[model samples]
Target: MTRAAELPGAASLVLASGVVHLDPAPAVFAAMLDGWAMQQRTRFLKASTIQSRTDLVRRFAAYTNEYPWQWRPVEVEAFIDHLRSGQRPIVVSTARGYQNTLRLFMEYVTDVRYAWPRECEEKFGRAPVQILHEWNTVAHVAEYEGDPRRRPLTYDEVQALFDAADGRVEEIRARRRKGALAAMRDAVLLKTVYAYGLRRREAWGLDLTDLRHNPKARQYGRCGAFYVRWGKSSKGSPPKRRTVLTVPEMDWIVPVLEQWLDEIRPGFGPGRLPALWVTERQSRLSRRSVNEAFEAARDAAGLPEELDLHCLRHSYVTHLIEFDYPERFVQDQVGHEYASTTALYTGVSDEYRNRLLQRSLDRHADRWSVS
Candidate 1:
């Protein structure tokens, strides 16, 4: 039999004389986690995602008081139970995400290419097994598991929010407040978010040059299309890109942006800043500022507390469907990879549904009358 020390790959460093006599199981386990993190970085996983997965694995290891080689299915169940017993118990979706991270980590460690399993086996006399099975893990039963209270704002609510935002700017100006310009920026930012159906980061990531003129809609001039360069990405991919065309319903924003770019933005003395939304510091606005702007507007409009900035995106989707835009067109406009993902954001009002039903009835009546 070949000595484990002579085994091919990194496992040779840990094993000797058919046994892991040089490195202890704990040391090997730590090294395996380090290697896994490095591998994830090489795969271009987001730093935040990599950190989150590492933390989950570390927490699991700490909970079971055992390394990966000693981890059993029962320990996995216990750790999940502990998570449920916490003060802020993990939600089903979060728990499922945790399980997925754990499963992926296990898969990496046990993969034949990694040599971790062989090293663990040489050290502990047993290899790591994938403890999370279909029976043990949470199933993805729903496409959308977001809070039920969070839904698209009514048309009236959207108008009210925008009005309140504008009102805030006016209030600040009337009081001779120092942040009057910033308040105006916030007001326009909120409107732009609703107009373009933008996610928070996507809205902030906008640059001055992103405002493109659609050759087809020359009447709208420079505000005909929004070139979104930082749309959401999946896994380790770069940000997705899409162009959101201006529709007749949102053409009003053309002038709003035109006035801002031609007048208000220059007044800020941006100098050479390229960001569409700028702060008093002459830097790009942060995501938190975007959230706070929406929150202030939502509260001033007397909307429900559960209504968040994301609800603006939901409202955009609902309104687009009501505007008779094709489903695929709406999906592409919002940068959704799938029609189903776009469907999840749609919360059409009962009134709109009734209108559709009424239209169907009217068509049937006309057909019967002609016959």
Candidate 2:
């Protein structure tokens, strides 16, 4: 596949310890890293973040069967269009993530080689960038029009979901000790993430030090930014940090976490939890584990199958919104980089629409009201 691109004087694209050199394209001197490569650089993120990006890229490669430039722009646009046809919107974002991946790849290739043949081709009118064909302006607006069915679950449902997850964690802890006190440790692990509303990557990215109740301990909210190593350029995530908490309720989880810390973790001690979560095998847990863990709990709790791991985070924020927590607080807690992004979480829930509608009519007031 690379040979085809090289006919125009493409040179060897070498990668050793992440220093890439695309030959002939001496301008391509930078290394392209997915999540896994970034993982080696910092202890801030859980292994799962790396795995997710790797999984995403692998899925893209498997589906496409060739490198990006090998496919015609029409072919890439077709795949984008096919994904958009699905009712599930997350599928589209998942597909779009590849664009980020490719952009990173191109960025690295451009840096390492100083310039690439593709640019030469583009300049000479031999190659063209693909247009995003799946969306029209109005339709694009409609595409993100919040789902009417997606109002957050009630408080009872939220508790029920966790209570359910607790049971499964108990079973996993019991069935697979792989450790001395995993059961007790896991219950708190499950609660801290779901109750606080962390995305799967956030949930997995925690280090034990991140949960520590001390000033010196690094903050989870700032992991992306505070740990400059985890920042953009290398990791290719949003270039900001989210808010983490100093919850007194975190006191509740401390002992179990402490127990897991002193006994189970690799570099266990005061001020040292190399990573927050781990596998039954005692290795760093991946985002996949968090998903599997949540799914197990959700299924066992008899929650709807549609209840994804992210739904719990959504439910947490919606509960805060319903209860009228400050918008900034909610945004910070959930790690939304954009206000528009935050609004989607805060305003898009069906509960608010229902609440607004409840105040609408004068005529039905007497009939519907007990007063």
TM-score of each: 0.90, 0.55
| Candidate 1 global TM-score | 0.90
lDDT of candidate 1 at residue 342, scale 0 to 100: 93
lDDT of 1 by residue, 1-371 (tens): 55533433335343343444354766676667676777787778899988888898998998888888888889988888889986888888888888999999898778767777776675579988899999999889888887889999888999999999999988888888888888788888999999999999999899999999999999999999999999999988999999999999999998889888987887788889999998878888899999999999889988899889999999999999988899999999999988999999888888889999999998889677853
- Which stretches of candidate 2 lie above 4 Å from their native place? 1-139, 142-151, 169-184, 212-239, 246-273, 279-281, 347-371
Tens-digit lDDT track of model 2 for 247-324: 333334444445555564433332333666765555667767677766666677787777666776677677667766
Best by TM-score: 1
Ten contiguous residues with the weakest lDDT in model 1: 6-15
Off by over 4 Å in 1: 1-26, 366-371
Clashes of each: 0, 18
